[model samples]
Target: MRNKIITVCTAAVMLVMTASCGADKNMKKGEKFLAIGEYYEAAIQFKKAYGKTPPKERDKRGQRAAKLARCYDRMNSHQKAIAAYRNVIRYKQDTPETHAALARLLLKNGNYKEAAREFQTVLDTLKGNRLAENGLESALTAQRKKEEGSRYIVRKMDVFNSRRADFSPMFYGDEYDRLYFTSTRNEAEGDELSGITGTKNGDIFYSEKDDKGKWGKPQTIESGLNTEFDEGACCFTPDQREMYLTQCTSDPAYPRYATIVTSNRTDAAWSKATKLDITRDTLSSYAHPAISPDGEWLYFTSDMPGGKGGLDIWRVRITGAGLGGVENLGEPVNTAGDEMFPTFRPNGDLYFSSNGHPGMGGLDIFIASPDKKTGKFVLEHPGYPLNSQGDDFGMTFEGPHNRGFFSSNRGDGRGWDHIYSFEKPEIIQTVKGWVYEMEGYELPAAQVYMVGNDGTNLKLSVKGDGSFTQVVNPGTDYIMLATCKGFLNHKEEISIRQTDESEEHVLQFPLASIRVPVLIDNIFYDFDKYTLKPESATALDELVKLLEENPNVTIELSAHCDYRGSEAYNKKLSQKRAETVVEYLIAHGIAKDRLTPVGYGKEKPKTIRKKLTEAYPWLKEGDVLTEDFIKQLDKDKQEMCNQLNRRTEFIVLRTTYGMFDEKGNLKNPPKPAKEENKHDEDEIFDIFIE
Candidate 1:
């Protein structure tokens, strides 16, 4: 099957002449050029031969068309190859190989339906055809893989692409500020064009970032590093003192086979490269070198003797200045189909492109993570748009981040590989909380004890504003306790939410102050009755927890009423309501002696707070809601003041309860239990206006 290269070309429609001599001569010349890998010249000869042959000679015309198509395929002229293959089929000269090549080209051009048919046609006869089977799977996967696309933001690196194929991006040096890649640009050393890509043979080129962080124009590496032959697909040692790369030397007498070579870095320039004696098998190709992060293994692609499949990833141990025996990575990393372009993230993840695995299309990239139990790599496909229905390979990461550049021919009609930058933004999650007195302002001196299910135990201090923000991991459960001197701890439990965007979770830590009475908001009761409403359970339960958090503290539950009611009636109602709250607290595990109920009636008025002024701009902070003060306001404002006055609250009586006895000796803790009490006062109560 044809590899990734030329696709589209301008059509040359010429009427075939009933010529004999010129057609035969041109066809033979085309065959010679095609055999020697002069695809550009081969295509020229075949096209002329196809045109000169008589139209009635369909077989001869088809042969020439198929030959031209093969050249176009190798040159990355995808569209032209597709058109030429159709001609070969229309003329009744199509073979299984021809159909397989057409299937690949059609798939790259997004004609999956037609490509599938072609693949099936070839696979029906050639049951062991790996290319056809892989192509069929790619066709189906390409249609369904998009919904599972990753969060990676991929963009073409236009500065790195050229008219010809430019691929295999590699980061250079410790700083990762320089980028090296293989390009077949016209400026490359070779005067002759590559029959493979219809451009000059590939050369190593590099670009460095300027002070402004923009990559400067790419420049060819000096002389000894590059030669007339194809030199690219390179990797550097951790120290960058040694370079390993692929080099393909051309010889018309035989087929060109790629071999790995090494070059030493002398000063700022690379010394002349020498072929690595990897194995005795001269018929095989060795290319695409990658150095492990630890610099202990040299991973490269080879069709060597012991490979599991076509072009499997193999590794040779780096022993000082020499290499050890090679080992195939083996299944499922190496499939029956071609697997190439193996690279690594700084974090030991092996990334390679393969058509053997179920993929979107062409060479879709896969990540091989080291399985903890077996230490063997387990494959994972990072779904679209990091991969697509075209040849996608050559991944290079910038350090440990989930971001970097890779090469792909996706969306390019010519099937030329171009560099693309991709990044999956980090899921930044943080928990922001404010620790403050329940009835007062922020507790700036408060300390928060934080614990998480993910082994995170930390003591965080609040800022001057009593707010603490800490970075948290996603999908992890966490609990925080905000504590300060003279204050009962406030416990908050949360989980970092699962979402696509970075998230900030807000928590409120309203610590119960041991000195002042803290208003218990959200406490509700039946209108005109002291009977507690069902909704009052939540507030009462929280109070129970607060008392439990400070086991040594005793509290007095005080209830008050607005001045609209009679003094005696209000007092009786407030007293009954306070008694109800105490009962609820006692039922929820607080000691009966630790809680005392009191009724202040209309004698105690509420004070306006800064928060109240926000909703009612007419009111000011620190304004006492006495009967006289509430009456002068608007009807809504007056009710709001009264609503604030009719409240239930608690004040800490002593922090030594159940801790020290009359003898001043520390006593054992007391077990909390409920006790029965009778209160037959009137059932009058206030609304839960707040």
Candidate 2:
């Protein structure tokens, strides 16, 4: 009987010790998992421990719930995490961290009113809690803003419900019709898990819009490009020939680094992925690649050292050789808060998401432009209808259209992520066309001005291809004018109907040839002087108007000397006269290239010398008679002779026409024959001789 009792007691002691050892082992395992960011597994282990413990020792239920809340929050289940946090506070006394987390989650879920109250509760209960106090104020501010309506709307919401994390979205192709995103779904090829989060794995997946404008089912991007570790945050060149994406390596022995990998799209399949030499630090993580339209500037996000905060937006110059280091965006674009996911529009506007700026909650998409004065990107929060009180980012416009795609987890009831399309308001019609001289030459640097019926003039410079485009509101009659210095002005008028989709008007302006003499409309000069008088300013003004009207026309200003003077003296005098005309044009802001001076020196007279002599029989050929000879003759004779020679004229030397071949050479139109001058019976020319 004694031996039996001893054996039973010893067995009971051993069992108790084993149970304690197992309990301690589980606690350590849970702690280890949580330390490595495997919150889900830690929560599971904690739950098991809570379940197996006796009711007296089951106070760990609240702790397990807290752990579960953390896991759910990491998974972006803000609502669920909020509920779990509530349970934590209800069962275990309210903690500052719990209250703060709840308030944050509530704000992110767009429960601003409730969030404000929860934050106030934290301030009232927790002493010396600055973070909670600030959070409460932020929540209250958001509530006030919410009364004005959500800064952004959640149009369409869908979720990708993989067992692992899904993140980092990018648009590709000209139409932005296809979307590429990273997912840790079961379709990933590698069995290896992330060392940081211990997630199942990651691979790139593509979803494309179909004919009906609905997203087709997502499929993994084909072989050699997507590995088992992580492939995400992709950006494509504007031409869609090359793709840059982020790849995460899982080996802990090697420090964690997110490398930029590239692939070429050919034959409808991506080529084998090649690693880029963009990784500078072994511990730093670089991801979320965005290439500029010209593919010269590359923007990305990195958690490298010397960041303003957690993850900052960085950029590197890219060329055919490789990336040229990296630079942080700094300040307003990147704060102590994380900023990532950058994209550029076709118009050179930059759109990015950030939690650093003052926002509703979580990450909100913001826009930045280089400040004219500061020479830095001035970040501005996209207010009302573009940013909600949730994580709103990863936006890309659909081609050149205002329709865009972005990801949000705002009022969407589904716990999974879905792609949403944003349609911009249509308020104007865009006009596009080519501007050319009469001779088909692509006129670069031509000024295009649009005059509204109300006389509002908007000026735009023509591209190298002589193409100009502008956006004008409907219900406006626009007079479009193209002008290049020295070229004949071209004008067209269009009345845009409200129902017009887009206006495509091709305008061909025939510039007068440079060598063709054009009569100076109102220029009046003294009989033999090259100096422009005060009265000549009016005529010079008219010339200025003509030059302004024809920006691309290059002209030669020539002066003729009368047949009486020696050829050499006449040439010198004519050159001075032409130079005077050129000075007048230049003073009126006409570019020098538009004006060339030449002294015809009676060589190319409008009237034959014999005809002039026949009209007025000069007494002697070698007679160097001055103004006295003109006075000796009748006023009519001298005036007629003077009018024939003392004149300044313009001839277009070069006319630029739009629409050139690939070589960019000027194309001249066939010349028309000179028309016989018809003397109108009503036209009269009165000549006055002194």
Best by lDDT: 1
RMSD of 1: 19.6
lDDT of 1 by residue, 261-350 (tens): 999988778999999988788999999999987677989898877777678999988886688878899988998778999998866799
- Candidate 2 lDDT over residue span 545-593, tens digit each: 6666555567889887766778898898889878988988898798887
**What TM-score quantifies how close candidate 2 is to the native fold?**
0.57
After superposition, the stretches of candidate 1 with alpha carbons farther than 4 Å from their true spots are 1-18, 127-131, 427-690
Error of 1 at 365 (Å): 1.1
lDDT, model 2: 0.67
lDDT of each structure?
0.83, 0.67
TM-score per model over all chains: 0.59, 0.57
For candidate 1, report its TM-score.
0.59
Task: Provide the clash count, candidate 2.
Answer: 28
lDDT of 1 at 556: 90
